[model samples]
Structures are given as structure tokens and as C-alpha cells.
Target: MKKIKLSFDKFKDSTIYLNSSKSESNRLLIIKALSEKEITIKNLSKANDSVLLKNLLESENLVVWDAQDAGTSFRFLTSFLAIKKEHVVLSGTERMKQRPVKVLVDALNKIGAEILYLENEGFPPIYVKGKINQVKNKLDIPGDISSQYISSLILIAPLLEKGIEINIEEPFYSRPYVNMTLNLMNSFGIKSAVKGNKISIKNQEFSSGSYIVESDWSAASYWYSILSISDNINNLTLQGLKKKSNQGDSVISELMKSFGVNTQYKEDGIVLTKIKLDTEEIELDFRDCPDLAQTILVVAAYHKIKLKVSGVESLKIKETDRLVAMKNELKKIGCDFYEEGNYWILEKRRREIDDELSIDTYKDHRMAMAFAPLASKKSMIINDPDVVVKSYPTYWEDLKKVGFIIT
Candidate 1:
């Protein structure tokens, strides 16, 4: 395993430009393939996840698509391949195989797509034989599981022969991502309507046009963590972000304000500056933006802010068991973190910070990036720092520009 040691440095005023949103890029790739007319996408993400999805979609003789722990790729591609006329196998890394796909598989199977698990039940390494017979046009799926599964089915909804009507059960997690999918489909000339828990899309052909992906708000969360815990009078600018974004993680700007970080939107991007801390205790429900949970948790721990978090039960099935990973790793840095029922609480303890706390990434990109911001407060070594390539490939490089010493 490879590790990168990061140490605190004097806060520097720097402007860091971020890559395009991988979430938007992956959806656009799928929509582009479904469109009969020519479509162009600009500012696509350089993240390995987007790159892998793009490559796999463009491949001519693809027998096997190895997503390699890119969950979005696996879920989105699973639906994309389910409606095609070819036979393909979708598999991924060891960890990806452990992530559950049965919910999405059963949903697709209910709609007439043929997909069978090759190894374990409710997991990946599945064989897909695309021949949609249109058994059912309506699907009812539990929204608490993963929004990617919902987005996957909806993105291909217009392509289905009979179209599709989806009823996402209550207690939906990551609702904004589902909205992003529908909005992206709308941009491509497929109109969808969401009434309460029901989303309806008719059998319409996608229109070709140009789309420019916004900057990744999820990637920006780490910078928010860095600014939130930095020393006095710190100001950092992030480029290519919008005040209004389809991405749900844009809520980070408001959430970080609780941690003494303020945002000022400029024409090009936004600037984050340290401000007065508002509350002693913070309670957040990440049902719509679970990706920001780790960044928030780490910052709250560093500041010793009492935090109560809920709506993260899905974290157990992410790239790794994130909730358990947080419990183990945060303890190494002098914090007591645990889960009670549906809530995960973090309360700082009076313990000395380790001289050199080491964090294990567990092959999860968010874990690596989320904890890297902690180096702004203390010296730490992040094992498998390269894991960030899954979404934010330029994470460490951007950290260096903001005055973090990585060696």
C-alpha cells in the first residue's frame, strides 16, 4: 500500500480551479449514446470514473466492462446495457463486487431486461443479455437505497419501447441526484414529470444538443472542510462552480457556514473565507447529500463540535463500509464516533492528538479526500491517497496549491 504524508502549513490565499462534475458527465455519456442525433458535451470530468464509463460506452467489441469500483459506472452502465441488442458482462473490483446491485437488478428484470448474477446474489459480476420484451412499464423501487439505481433506470426510460413510470418509495435518499437525472434528460429533449413519489417518462426520442457540465460540488466539499478548520483570516477561491447547480452537494456552501465558512460567489466561481462559528452543536440529515457527510464529520471532529448525523444508512454499501470506516479512523485522531439507531454521532473527547495519525482510505475516494483536509489541523499520513482518482483525480495537487505539504 502507498501512503502520502501531509502536514499543516500557514494558510495561503489561492484560487483553485476544479474539474467538471463526474455525476453530470456520466449521465451525459449515457444520454448521448441513447440519442439518435449527434450530441456534444463540454467540460467533461477528468476523473477516472467518468473516463472509464466513457471508454466503456465507446468500445466496439466490449465483452466485459470492468468498472473497477466506480459504482456510478456500474449502476448506470447496467441500465444502459440492459436496453441494448448485445450480450455483455459487467464486473468490477473486489470491493465493487461486494456492493449490492440486487435492487437495481430486480427493477430492471421487472421491466423485461435479462440480467443474472454470475457469482453472488444481490451483487455484481452479472451477465446482461439485452432484449427488452416490455413485461411491465411501471416499477416501484425503494428510494432509500441508492439514487444511482434510480437515475440508471430513468436515464434509459425514454429508450424503452413502452417508456416507463417509476414510483420511488418514501424516505428517498439523494433526491437531488434523481432530479439531476430527470433535468439532464429534459435537456436532451426527453420530458419527465415527477408528481409526489411518482416519476413519469414517455417513449420519446432524445434530441441532440450541446451540454456543458458544471464543476463538481462533491469535490469542493473537501476544500470547504479545509477552510472551515484553517487558522484565522483564511480565504480560498474555487473556480468553475455555480451558485445554482443541478448537483445536490451544492448544499455544502450552506452546511459549511455552520463551521465558520462563508461563500461569496463571483462571476468565475466562489470564494470561501473563515467567519464566525455559529453553533456549538450541529445536526445534519444527509438524505439528499450523503457525499458531503464525511467532509462534514471530519471538520466537526477537528473543531470538537457536537454533531448528530442521520440519513447515512446507505453508507454501509458504498465503495466501502463508510460508516464503520469513519468509526475506526476518527478514533485514531482523538474523536469518539459511533452510530446509534439511524443516527451517527461525533463528540470530541479530551485526548491528545497523535503525533502522526494514519488514515486508511479503504479504497474509497471520499474517505481519502475527506480526511486529507484534517492535515490542515494536524499532521497525518493517508494510506492509498491515489484512491481519489475515482472521482477527483487532482485532489492532492489542488491541496498542494492551497499550502498543504504532501510528501
Candidate 2:
């Protein structure tokens, strides 16, 4: 229950180094397990989520995993354990249990994997007993929901005798993540295909091979938010992102364009420079990259820009009830956010800069990190600052590199 107090600080021209990407690390962990050749990954993410996933994969015995607050670990491990034929009780913190797993469980059951919800139906605190002997070669799961479930099944698909045939129920959100899973799997020598919404995999043993994870595009979004809010652009250079990235959040590059941050591709990573602001009201869909919703929402409110957003239904089941968190936290900062059917509206109003803003993170990493950039505009404090450990453990340290004041 640690709290961090942050104050407003102007960005002075400085060189900053950010940690590696957790998104890539988690995706790679599944690939490494499926690889037939011994694989070594470099520049892996140091986030607690990545660390937790690595430890769980290496653990032996009666494992009662405390995944902390990482939803990916929870979802991925559920599928991983089912395939291993091991008896494991997978659970998480109170917030984690509240997140839904029923969508994933039903899919696994259809594939002849035996899984039981220990307590609430469709939520966590799940029990995965020994594996079922049968494997259904072809199955259908909704793709419009969390793609973590799809990745979970894809990771263990190689080990199945019948392999897998996944029919995604809709056009799909987070297609890049599913593709990232397939791309990583191919790197490990197991090829899969997606035609329309139908994805098919052949049961081939994972051949071990080495692969490197790309830095996180999702983490880079915070820097974009900070640059948009700050008048100084000379103080920032984000490293390890690609101009062309498999990460769906790569759309952040184009999204930030509306906020006046121009991204430049370098050999090592991407560099962001602030540009002129657009006076037009902003409208965007978060269906593909729902995680970026909070960061974009905060930036829009700070800039006094009117915003309309959709494709955020998944927010309700994330690390926290993000829609509710945003609604409450934004109220604290003198702005209003409300859902009008499918669209979310942000009404902008200028407030006194001195009105001490204290944000409640609701155990969501994005909630804490997304709001942290607002410190550039005015001094603010975040409750449970440690919540960022779930995704980006070095978030506060990286903020310091950009000249943020933390105490």
C-alpha cells in the first residue's frame, strides 16, 4: 500500500532511458515454451508482469500462483497449465479475481480442456485439474473480447495432438496481439494462419530457437502524452520502438500526430518532437488498443480538447473497472466524463492549476501511469503508485529521466 507524491516539473533538455517492453516479453515467454530449440531472449521487459510470468514458468510443485495484478499472466497460464496436465490453482489479488475468465474457460472446455471456476462463474480464482486426453482440432472463440484468451490457446496449440483450429467470432479487436502471438510462434518454427476470422494451427512440437522481444509501444504512449502536454520537446528521446511494429498500439504514433508530437524512427528506437496543436475536436476508437484509452483521455482533458471515444467495452473487465475509474478520477481534476451509449464524451473546462489533484489508481497500471503525465501540467499525487508494477515497473524512474519531480 505505498503511495507516491509527485509534483509538477518542467521538462529540461535531458537524455532518458526507458526499460524494455513487457508486451513483447510476455508474448515471447509463450513462444520460448513452444520453441523446439533452446531460446534466449534479449532486452526482455523488467516489468513485474514479465517477472511473474518467467517465475511461474520456472516453478515446480504444488503451485499456487499469485499473479499479482497481471491479467495476461492469469489468462496465459490458465491455458498453459491445462495443456501441461498439471494440477494448479491459479488465482490473483482481489482485483484480479474480479476480472472475467469465463469467456476463456468456455473456449477451453469446448476444446476438451477441463477447467472449473472455483468461485464465481466467468471470473478468476480458477482451478485447472489434470489435462483431458482429448483435444478438439477446430473451435470458435469470440475475438472481439480480450485477445489474451486467443494468445493463451495459440501458445499451447503446438503441443496438442490435433493442433487447433480457432474461428474468431467477430472482425476482432487487438488483431495485432494475436498476430504477434502467431509471428512469435513462427519464429519458434510453428506456423499458423488467419483467413478472415478463422485461424488454424497444426500440432507440431515446438522447435527450440532464440528470439528477441521488441520494446513496448504501449509504454511509449505515456511519453507521447507528456510531450503533447509540455511546451519543451528537446528533453525527450524514447528508445527501442520500431517505425513498423507488430504491436497494435503502434497506432499511437499516428494518434499522437493529432496532439502535435511527430515521431521519428532511428536505428535504436523512435524519437518524439512536439508540434502545433489541432483545434478540431478529436474522435477515436479504442477497439484495437483499449489499453491506451486512459492515457489519451487524460491528455485530451488536460489540453481542453473535446473528445468522443468508442470500442472501450473491454475496459470494464480489465485490471480495474477503467470506465468507472476514469469517471471518478476525472471528476477529481475538474473535468466530466460520461458514457452516452457506445460513445464516451469528455467535456473540457479549465481549472485552477493549484488545486491539488490526488488520483486513485483502482489497482490498474494504466490508471496510475496514464495520470502521471498530468503532473507536467500541475502537481499531483497517485494513490498506490506501486500499481504500475503490473506492466511497467520502471515507469516512475523513466519519468525522472524526463525531469519529473517524484518524492
Model 2, C-alpha of 336: deviation from truth (Å):
1.4
* Stretches of model 2 off by over 4 angstroms after superposition: 9-13
List TM-score per model, in order. Answer: 0.97, 0.95
Model 1 lDDT per residue over 187-257, tens place: 98999888999999999999889999999999989888888877733888899999989999999999988
Q: Residue 320: error of model 1 in Å?
A: 0.5
Candidate 2 local lDDT, residue 125: 90
Off by over 4 Å in 1: 11-13
lDDT (tens digit, per residue) of candidate 2 on 1-407: 67777865655644456667777788788667545568889988888889989987777674676777888988988887787746678898888888888888888888878888888988889888778456567778887779899989888888888888888888588888888888877876888877988888887877666766777888889888988887644436777778877788989999988877888888988788877887458889999899889999888888888889998888998877899999998877777899998799988845754445888988788999898888876778789998887778888887876677888
Best lDDT among the predictions, by candidate number: 1
Give the best candidate by TM-score.
1
lDDT assessment of candidate 1: 0.89
